[model samples]
Target: MKKYLVQFKPFLIFIGTFFATYILLTLIYKSYLNHFESDDVDEITRIVGYNVDLLLHAFNSDVFIQKSVSNPWLEVWYNNDYVIRIVEGCNAVSVIILFISFVIAFSRKFKTTFLFILSGTLFIYILNIVRIALLAILLFRYPEKVHLFHGVLFPLMIYGVVFALWVFWVNKFSKYAK
Candidate 1:
C-alpha cells in the first residue's frame, strides 16, 4: 500500500490541486452571481454582451445587445435579427476557472504560473467575445443551422483553443515538462 501510494503521489497531488482550485473559483464566481437579482443578468455576462456588441459594430455590422426584461440574459440582435442570448455561461468565466486550475495543478514557479494564468484568462475572455460575435453573425445568416453553429462548432472552437493551451502548458511551461 505504501509503495503504491508513493508511486501515485504526484498524480494524486495533481488531481487534488486541480479540483480544489476549480471548486474554490467556481464557488467564488457563484457567490458573485448570487449578488444579482434573479431577473437581472450578472455583471460579467453584461460585459461580455457589451463587448460583443462593440466588436460587431466595429466590423460595420448591425448589432446590439440588451438585457432581457423577463430573464437573466442579454438578447443579442444582429443585422436586425434576434440571433442569440448571452447568458452567464457564455461569459467564459467557467472556462477561465478550468484553465487556471489546470495551470496551477501543473505549476512550478510563482511568477510563471501567475503570468500564464493572467494571460491565459485574458486570451480566453477575448476569444469568447469574438466567438460570440462570430456566432451571432453566423446564426443570423444560417438560422436553420443553429444546432451546428451554436451547439457544436462554436463549442469545439473554444474548447479546442483551451486544449491547445493545455498542451502548450504541459509541453513548455509546466513543472512536468522539466
Candidate 2:
C-alpha cells in the first residue's frame, strides 16, 4: 500500500488539489449569493449576461435588445419579445473553475501558472459571452435547429477550447512538459 501510494503520489495530489479548489470556489460563490435578497443570477453572471445582450445588439441593431435583470435572472428582449433568459448555468463559471483546477494540478512556476490561469480564465469568459450572444442570434434565426446548435454545437465549442488549452498547457507550460 505504501509503495503504491508513493508511486501515485503526484496523481493523488492533482486529484486532491482539483477537487479542493473546485469545491472551495463553489462554496465561496454560494456564500456570496447569501448576501443577496433575490435568488437571481449572481453578480458576475449578471454581468456576463448583460455583456452578451449588448454584444448581440451591437451586431444586429435591428434586434432591439433589452436586458431585464430584475433579480438573479437576466432576460434578453428582442424587439419586445422575451427571446432568452440567461440563468446561472449559462455564465460559464463552472467551466472556468474546472479549467483553473486542471491548470493548477499540472502547474509550473508560480508566475507562469498565475498568468496562464488569469489569461485562460479571461479567454474563456469572453468566449462564453460570445457563445451566448451567438447562440441567441442563431436560435432566433434558426429556431428549428435549437437542439443541434445549443444542445450539441455550442457545448462542443466551449469544451473544445478548454481541451485545446489543456493540451497546450501539457505540451508547453506544465512542469511535466519540461
Candidate 3:
C-alpha cells in the first residue's frame, strides 16, 4: 500500500490540484456571469463598443449606431466611423480556463505542453467569441430558435471544446502515464 501510494503521489497531487482549481474557477466564473446578468456590465461593454465606433466614425465619417436588446450581452452599431460591438460571454470563464490550463501544462515540464495548452485555450476563446456573435446574429435572424441556440447548441459546442481539450491533456501528456 505504501509503495503504491508513493508511486502515484505526484499524479494524485496534480489531479487534486486541477480539480480544486477547476471548481474554484467555476464558482468565481458564475459570480462574474451573474453580475453581468444584472445589466451593469452588459451596458458598459455596449457603450464602450459604441463609443469606439463613434470615435472611429468621427474621422472616417462612416458611422453607425446600435442599441441593446433583450439579450443582455451587447449593443452594436455601424456607420461612417466604424462598427461598435459589445461582446460578453464565457469571457471570465475563458480567462480562468486559459490560466489554469497554462499552469497545469507548464507544471508537467513537457516541451510542447504549454504550447498545446495555449493552442487549446486560443481555440476555445475564438470559439467562444464566435459563439456569442452567432447567438446575437441568430437572435436577430431566427428569433424562435433563440431558445434552442442559447440553451442547447451553444453550451454543447463550448463544452465540447473543453472536453476535447481535456482529452488532449490526458492522452498526450497525462502524468499518470507510465
Q: List clash counts for every candidate, in order.
A: 0, 2, 10
lDDT string for model 2 (118-160, tens) is: 9999999999998888777777778789899889999999999
**Which candidate ranks first by lDDT, i.e. highest?**
1
User: What pairs collide in candidate 1?
Assistant: none
Question: What's model 1's overall lDDT?
Answer: 0.92
Provide the overall lDDT of each model, using Cα atoms, as 2-decimal numbers: 0.92, 0.82, 0.58
Clashing pairs in 3: 57-81, 61-80, 62-79, 62-80, 62-81, 63-79, 63-80, 63-81, 64-78, 64-79
lDDT of 3 by residue, 34-85 (tens): 7655644554345444544555455563434454555444454333222224
Question: By TM-score, who's the top model here?
Answer: 1
Who is ahead in lDDT, 2 or 3?
2
Candidate ordering by lDDT (highest first) = 1, 2, 3
Residue 113 CA displacement from its true place in model 1, Å: 0.5
Per-candidate TM-score against the hidden true structure:
0.98, 0.90, 0.57
Ranking by TM-score: 1, 2, 3
Candidate 3 segments exceeding 4 Å error: 1-11, 23-73, 76-89, 92-107
| Model 1 C-alpha RMSD to native | 0.7
Predicted candidate 1 versus true structure: per-residue lDDT over 90-175, tens digit per residue: 99999999999999999998999999899999999999999999889888988999999899999999999999999999999999
